[model samples]
Target chain A: MGSSIAANQLVWHHDLTGQVLDPASLNLFWFELTEGAYGQIHRVKAIVEIVDGSAWQLSFNQGEDPMETELPVERWLSGRPDRPSQIEVVAGVDFDPIGVTAACRVAGSPMRYYSIIKPSCGSSHENRGYFLYSWQL
Target chain B: MKIAVISCIHGNYEALNAVLSDIDDHKVEQIYCLGDLVGYGPHPNAVVEMVRSLNIPTVQGCWDEDIIEGLNACECSYPSILAEQRGKLAHTWTDQEIHPETREFLAQLPMTLRVDNLAFVHGSPNNQHEYLLPEIDAFTAMERVLGTGADVLFCGHTHVPYVRDLSDGLVKVQVKRSGVSETATQIHVAPLKRIINAGSVGEPRHGRPNATYVIYDPESAEVKLREVEYDYPKTCAAIIDKGLPAIFAWRLARGLEYAERAEDPTHICER
Candidate 1:
């Protein structure tokens, strides 16, 4: 099990890519990190922006256990019924021995990223990837 | 023999009654309606029963589809939404306001009608939602006519009367700028592909608040757009007494074009 950190608690460490992102990008890094004897888990917050400027938030938790070592991720883009563009993950999670990778790829292009989390479990485990985001004007 | 094409009655029983009375003198052989028998105006069942009694050949319109179906069944403009809501509200009146048989008839009406070489529809042949207004360009008009294989296409959704001829390697849009006057003007139809909007019988949009209809002669190939003044006060009173929306009555007083004016960006006031 995992828990996401508050937006105020997350520190904007580095851009890493030096790409210009929106001020609202701060919400991307809000995640919680927990470590246990077996492995580490990360809980990420999902944010959705509707065409009417309405925002919806969902919580997704990723846990690492002996039976399962990955978390789920979903992303979507553009909520307009006339024109819809979305990105989502059906199964699996992203796992890295040193850090957890959460990337949002929209319309064949990557736009946002979440801070990486290193699992304290071990280096032999495989990482799972999942994310979703949707935007509309 | 003179034939009248009336459409978009929109349940305005008073205006429809007045127009029917005026046309009774013409001795018309047949009266054909181009759909939209109910919407915006007040009496749905009354208008439906009146049209049914006439035994006129009618077509289905977008408004009719919405009332019988639902709003999401088709796309619509903002004013169309208002008109549809008013129609839904009118359902609260007497049960005789909208008979089940009338609804069945409206649902069963065809989208297109072929009377000899003349084609009839609620809007354009290409799309029932489109409005073939007089102000539109000739090329666009030609596209609409070409989409249908009829020599003459009669339509009535924009509530404006005009003729478009697309033959002899030339396209022309003949617009009736004024309503029927003391001296009646005759429209000569050539042997070519043409699109004609018979305008509205109950509600006219062209400056003139009078009810409009067209008399089409197949033999002489002539089409005459005629307008007759009705008792607006009686129509307004009926609408108000029926508890219909105020915009319906207000628009009749001004005769302000709704469909065309809404499309113009400069005419934001209408929006």
Candidate 2:
């Protein structure tokens, strides 16, 4: 997951190789629900950028909106149906079990969360989603 | 007799107005509502009052039951966790905003209403939350119609409209005794049965923000699906202003379910 970062954003994208995205993982979605339940997965990817002011921003994908991006990381996402609104990252302390922390402000409510290493196992495949830093609340 | 049927009018007074106008154009004698008169939109009481004023024979929907008796049908709400959260928000908003008289009106509605051989129900004969998807097996479809003892069953709840014809139905009965060999008898229904889904009058989910219903002609046995275009943006604005879940507005604008669609078509609603 970290391999796509633009260098200084968090060193080099972590060389966590050959990770296949799970269709049921958490993410934002927009459109008609497919027979598989989740909608079209165009160029959608979870992007959590630790920005200039020691804050991080999360979007399913970086889109036209300059303030916030419309993207989902998994099958389920919280926010507007078409795309998530701009969530102001007010604070990010050193979160445990992962690299960073973040409090996202959505619809005038502060949702505080941090990163965690979620390991999911299946019979035939085991794909890991890792980054230089991931947070959970 | 030509009858007009509507269902899943989740409190959008604007869409209800448009559908009623279209039904008037069809010159139908009777108008039957397949329930879900309230929930997920701006004006619940206004929509109920309109239906009451029109004297539309209505059945109780899952949302109506939830508001009156409480939200117990967890499975009927949504499939996604995020969608479930939004469903709770909408349900809570509706429960808080619903008037006492409107609640009484919804509580008095029957689950199933029959007129001669034509039956009306919100979802299926089994329950309001059970979805009779268009692609369900033929035997199950025939069973739903036969359960009502009706040649034709008119229903809604899936929000997507469809028509299914149950033809060439055969049932075999077998009896076995300890001292006798198994005996079997076959019975067949001569006339083909039909399941007509009225779709949704307010919150539609057929890929467009237009209301849908069905006009049934008893003489010719013809079911015509009607789609009506309304000022949906008005309802969308109301959803945001009413302090309901904002996701409902986005979904409503696109003719999607306010929360989520039915996940399991075969699983009967246990709630």
Candidate 3:
């Protein structure tokens, strides 16, 4: 039964979001891992262009946080501190209503989700956008 | 002679059974399926076997592709997750339900087929991933149908039946109001390229739970959309017994359509 079943099943996999570390003191980072399996080690970078001409950079490393010294100690040690699985960068832009461009790289793998989050100022008064760039590993 | 095009069984053996019983007497020379022999619905294996027994020319729908090749996993909308979960359940119930032979059969189905100048596609011809509904104007339909080079194109992804005529250089689609009961409906308009959705055989979105099929005669250039009543109780029971999604089975009890919330990306349950 196992052999018959295995023959019919089709295995599917996707790339994980590359690690991005934020050095800003007030920003935050979160990682949402893919469900099933992981692929080869691929490098990814996100260059976030702030409205005020400032920019933030996030990078991925296999066993260490590339921007560990720059991130807030509390958040940097919050989840999976022992082994840096993935990285996320949270930055605040002072520009009242401006857009940020994010570009990610995973070598041969494709980036699944990317977006600029604009937190609400108390009463749902901010606009934001999410874009996904997906490709095979 | 009349030809009924039905696709996307997605399990739901009862619905397929009901539709078949309803059309048992109809003089259908050929019955075409738009793919998705299993998924979401109950009795994936049973539904596949039945469609195969009927000898209908079935195409490989997106849902079918998901099961066999994982083509749209990243893009499978939220409702699709629920639908996929149901498929996985069905897969486990029947010992991985679909066999290699069935998977191969489904894989070989043409994405698009032309019968007497009418092109039949499970989704849209331009992109099998697209869902072309009747609500969109004829211009959108024309744009999608531009290079297909068919007098008529029939699709069934939205599970909603509609007709669009793009002959007079103006695009116009006739939206069949849901819940209108009619034995036979006629579409009287000449079109350079016509778009028609045959609706769903296993699941009908219109308030009435009757399975729907479209009969078109190329020789006479006449088309009629017809609905046949089926055994809803039996279908619903099979769905329930299989421990499928309660909504998946429950929705069939009443012909009310499922509405997907805007925030939800997966709205497969919504008709």
Every model's DockQ: 0.01, 0.06, 0.02
C-alpha lDDT (0 to 100) for residue B250 of candidate 3: 45
Best by TM-score: 2
Show model 2 residue runs off by greater than 4 Å. Answer: A1-44, A47-137, B75-77, B173-190
Fnat of each prediction, in sequence: 0.00, 0.00, 0.00
After the best TM-score superposition of candidate 3, give how far the Cα of residue A48 lies from its true spot, in angstroms.
33
Give the TM-score of each candidate.
0.55, 0.70, 0.56
* Candidate 1 lDDT, B180-206, residue by residue in tens: 445545433344678778888767788
Residue A41 displacement (Å), model 3 = 52
Candidate with the larger lDDT of 2 and 3: 2
| Model 3 lDDT per residue over B145-213, tens place | 654667788888676677776786543445566696544444334357778887777766776777777
Count of backbone clashes, every candidate in sequence: 27, 17, 7
Sort order, lDDT high to low: 2, 1, 3
In terms of lDDT, the poorest run of 10 residues in model 3 chain B is B258-267
Measured with C-alpha atoms, the lDDT of residue B109 in candidate 2 is 99
Best by lDDT: 2
DockQ of 3: 0.02
